[model samples]
Target: MEIVLYIAALVAAIGFLVLCVSLAMTLTSLKKTLNEVSGTMSGLEGQLQGVTRETTELLHKTNELASDIQSKSEKLNSVVDAVKNVGESVNGLNTSVRRITSSVANEVEKNEEKISQVIQWSNVVLEIRNKWKERKAIDEGRSGYSNFKD
Candidate 1:
């Protein structure tokens, strides 16, 4: 009975020691996993910082580009306004020209009969002048022939 009790005690001690060894091994493995997780977290933090800096720079550049575009758009608006003014001036000029042309056409229509009468008078005057020149030439020819005979 004494030997059996001693054997039982030794067995219990051996089981406890085995349990402690297993627990230690498990704890060591967990520690190594935690260290690896810590290293990975540090690398991720550094990458995140780099991304944040690049994002800030990009945001600044985008703002500058937007400002430049706004300025150019404002300048373009002035050019568009000038073009509109020119178009209005051209339209006014065209209207004036059309009015003048219509007035001239109306005046020409009103004077159509007078213009025809004037043309007829000018033709009659030209015919009279031609007849006088013919008479002068005939008289000169008769005088010249008489002097030649003499």
Candidate 2:
């Protein structure tokens, strides 16, 4: 019985030593994991800062482009107004030409009767002159002249 007691005491001491070693190893592993987490957090922060700077620059550039487009739109509007003015002027000229053409046509219509009368008078005059020349030639031939005098 005394020998058995000594063996039992030795086994308890060995078990206690094994427990202490396991606890130490667990603590060391936990410390290493915490360090890795800290390193990863620092890397993420650096990336976030870079993204923030780039986003600020992009916003500024977008605003500048918008301002430039606005200026160009204003210029384009002026050009469109000028073109509209030109179109109005051309329409006015077209209206004037149309009025003049109508006036000329009206005048020509009014003169149609006078032109017809003049043509009739000219024809009558030509026929009378020819008849008069024939009569004079016949009269001279009967009067024993060789030819009618001019």
Candidate 3:
């Protein structure tokens, strides 16, 4: 009965030792996994900082571009205003030309009858002068002397 008790005690001790060894191995594996996780978290933190800096720079550039575009738009607006003024001036000039042309046309229409009367008077004067010259020539041939004699 003593030998059997000792054998049972020895078996219990061996089992306890094996359990302790297994627990130690599991703890070691857990520690290694925790270290890997810690390393991965640090890398993630570094990437996040890089992204933050890049985002800030991008925002600054966007603001600068926006201001530049605004300034250019202002200048373009002035140019467009100048073009509009030139177009207005051209329109005014064209209107003045049209008014003058219409006035001249009206004046010519109003004077058409007077112009025809003047032409008739001129023709009558010319015809009278021609008749007087013919009479003078006839008298000169009869008297053998002309009014144009020096």
Candidate 4:
């Protein structure tokens, strides 16, 4: 019976040694895998830093571009205001011209009969002057009296 116990204990010890060896092999494989993961993480961190820097630069450029656009827009607003003022001035000038034209047209319409009478009077005056000149020429003997007409 003692011999049987000794053999059993020896077999158990052997089994324990085998388990330790298997565990060691597994831990060694795990260590190698961890080292590879760490190296990959380092590379990923470097790429992330580069991306962050590029994003920051891009953001800064965007801000500058926006600022430039704002300045240009402000300058354009002044031009727009000037154009609006010019348009208003043109409208005022057109109104003034229209009023003057309307007043002149109204005055001409209101005095049409008077203008016609004045024209008739001028014709009568001219005829009288011509007759007087013919009479004088005849009396002075500057023209043949027989050639004079009434």
* lDDT digits (tens) for residues 52-145 of candidate 2: 9999999999999999999999999999999999999999999999999999889989998998999999999999999999999898787766
Query: How does residue 100 of candidate 4 score in lDDT?
Result: 100
> Alpha carbon lDDT of residue 81, candidate 3?
100
Count clashes in each candidate, considering only residues at least 3 apart in sequence or on different chains: 0, 0, 0, 0
Model 4 Cα RMSD, 1 decimal: 6.9
| lDDT for model 1 | 0.99
TM-score of 2: 0.54
lDDT of 3 at 145: 57
**Which has the greatest lDDT?**
1
Pairs that collide in candidate 4 are none
**Candidate 3 displacement at residue 73 in angstroms:** 1.8
TM-score of each: 0.66, 0.54, 0.55, 0.63
Global lDDT scores for all candidate models: 0.99, 0.94, 0.97, 0.96
Lowest-scoring 10 consecutive residues by lDDT in candidate 4?
Answer: 141-150
Q: What TM-score number comes out for model 4?
A: 0.63
Off by over 4 Å in 1: 1-15, 117-150
Per-residue error at 43 for model 2, in Å?
1.7
Candidate 2 regions exceeding 4 Å error are 1-30, 113-150
Q: Regarding TM-score, does 1 or 2 come out ahead?
A: 1
Residue 115 displacement in candidate 2 (angstroms) = 6.1
Q: Which tens-of-lDDT digit does each residue in 111-140 have in candidate 3? A: 999989999999999999999999999987
